[model samples]
Target: MTLHQQTTRRQFLQGTAAATAGLLVPFASRSFAFQSPNERPVFATIGLRNQGWGITNKSFKFADFAAFADVDANVLGENLEKAAQRQGKKPDGYKDYRKILDRDDIDAVMIATPDHWHTKIAVEAMLAGKDVYCEKPLTLTIDEGKLIEETVDKTGRVFQVGTMQRTESGQRFLQAVALIKNGRIGKVKKVTCGINGMQASPVIPEVKTPEGLDYDFWLGPAPKVAYRALPEMREGYGGGVPLYSNCHYSFRNWHEYSGGKLTDWGAHHVDIACWAIGASDTGPSRVTPLDYTLPVEYKEGYPVVDDQYNAATQFNIQVDMPNDIEMIITSEGDNGILFEGTEGRFFVNRGKITGKPVEDLESNPLPGGAIEEVYGGPVSENHTANFIDAMNSRKQPISDVWSHNRMLEICHLSNIAMRLGRAVNWDPAKREIVGDSQANTFLSREYRKGFEIDM
Candidate 1:
């Protein structure tokens, strides 16, 4: 079937399923025939970088790539060829992501752009009638999270945040939450999340923008600034680019584009911590920056120096969670979460879960379908599979925006507390800072001219 015909067929099937069952059926249990290319959902990916390519690469089995968009032409071309080889069909490419949203044939979009660009693209995509699967730390500021949440509710779209631990990580996190709920760790008291720290960089000089890269578009919604980089190349998983540049993988080290490790790793571990403790629906009462070391000086919350990484290099914060539970977020010790309660405690990360309680699980064992109960259904093949399932059911996926934003508020407040060198009070009900007006100003940002969200 042609692309248009295939889209129509899928819509008819979806509507039929909803009508027959009085609700959309989950993708796994539904007896829909989707073995052919024409039956797969049409998808496009924006921001062809480390995570942009990662999510799209995993989604190939469930969706057909109709297009790809990126501000850097070189990166776009390279990923297009890679995608074609993998799927045996070349997709159209564009530097502007809006062109992809303009296509009616596209059913959904996977946004893995920089933290600064996430909110704009995601909100616009949903407005254009497309489901979204955006990477975590979903918003640059707390206000942006509210904007995306409002848009999702307004558009009735299937939105999924890319916190794959909810679906992947070998279901270890699921088991961890299940254990907590089953009283394996009775009356949880304190939870520590050691997300680790990033290295401080030497002063990076301003350099000419690289060829085939649109520097202005890359800085969308962020303050306009000179492109900066050093000649030294990073030598690991996210290498080839300058190790100290304020772009690419190094963007995580700057406050303009990302929230450093606080929002980076914190998005993952803190999210799981809140879920296990039954605080996913609520917010913290206070966030105090006990100790932290910023790479550069800061007069207010804004950084003083423009060259070096400004985000906290090493830090520790104390968060007052609901029920008087104390949560410690620090960049020390092993990179994982340690959950301590009245009865027992355990440590969990992407690799393993260890503790006396975990050891006893082999003999005592969780009740049948315990993990599924936490997950709300049978686990899918991967995170992307869960997104596709949500698309079919028209239901929110495992990592919904509400829970993600609630946990992310802790991380955002931590950075704010560290920047101001004081504790900040948070009224979860109002979703705003209590008394500190200056600190509350950091909750939202002014967008660069011409790049503001149309909403």
Candidate 2:
């Protein structure tokens, strides 16, 4: 029940620098402040609204709740009240998330904060010896992905990205991956991912920060802006259109905190595409944005308009994968993947999977127990449960950092290419945009002072 002192980055490296892969032994290798023979792992969540509690609700089945942190104090109090009522335990509340990371009793953390905050908290959590289940669009930029991937290796923490499409019910995405890997679609030639475009945003006036919300802390690494009250204008996707600075759910439509739909939905669809084409740890050799239209005027890849949404609304991007497979990612069609090969083609989304190969599954089906194979073993009850299993055994989760980083890197490159409105050669091994200095700059951003990730 007691919280430990925050571990300095130097202390973390000093503790872990000597540990090597040959000496590592999974769950047995790490030290925990509370690890009795049979007790469930303890967890804390940093972001307490929407997806934060949504993930914690599922995590209760696998781990005990110890603490909750949020910049917004009201949500923290509310979520803790719900935690007490649901779990019969009162969790400590933290306004700054670092306090949660300092807890030695907690074994894991769920980082459902905005995209920009994902890497900082996840890296620090692992550095403090907590396993992490970070929500999707794992990195705000390509640089963060590398940092996280390296830290996972250095710390040996079980990390899972919130890409649920990898483990959806009936194993639909697994089937797609399995079909492609098994040559069900002979020699993949092209792929099309039609995730919706960034929705339009009208001019929003800057206003006062809400009383209980910690707007500055919520902004974290993002550039600071005066808090604005965003109107609930549209329904479903891209609504609320919160200040392009720090968004509630509308962050996905902005580039400052996210990659718009490119990294929003692309994180899922493009991830599957990467898995299908066997390019999880590697990336494309070239990324060229075709016809593109930004929602706002731009110079040097930043928005000129202060209040209008700045992400591209129309884009047809061409990415050349390592395996001679070319993918066209666009903002059109039925929000799904259409895989084409020399032999045949099929389309799949959350609703259904279809085409000759999928139809052939009825007569000439995939091998017995194939879905589990694509799931990287047993089909879990859900992604959270899968992460818990990995935490116990020290195995890599289904949606892992290395692969997710590759997928995310591709998405980041697509945005950079689109913003530049030109073809950009990529050197995935180097993790750089080759040749173009301006293009290279987009690979990462300058973190606001005091909010930078301590490598």
> Of the candidates shown, which would achieve the greatest TM-score relative to the real structure?
1
Provide the lowest-lDDT 10-residue window in model 2: 7-16
lDDT of each: 0.87, 0.79
Report the backbone clash tally of model 1: 0
Q: Give residue 205's error in model 1 in angstroms.
A: 0.2
List of clashing residue pairs for candidate 1: none
What's the CA error at residue 3 for candidate 1, in Å? 12
lDDT of 1: 0.87
C-alpha lDDT of candidate 2 relative to the true structure: 0.79
For candidate 2, the per-residue lDDT at 447 reads 89
Residues 177-249 of candidate 1: C-alpha lDDT, one tens digit per residue: 8889999989999999999998899999999998999999999899888999999898977766888898888
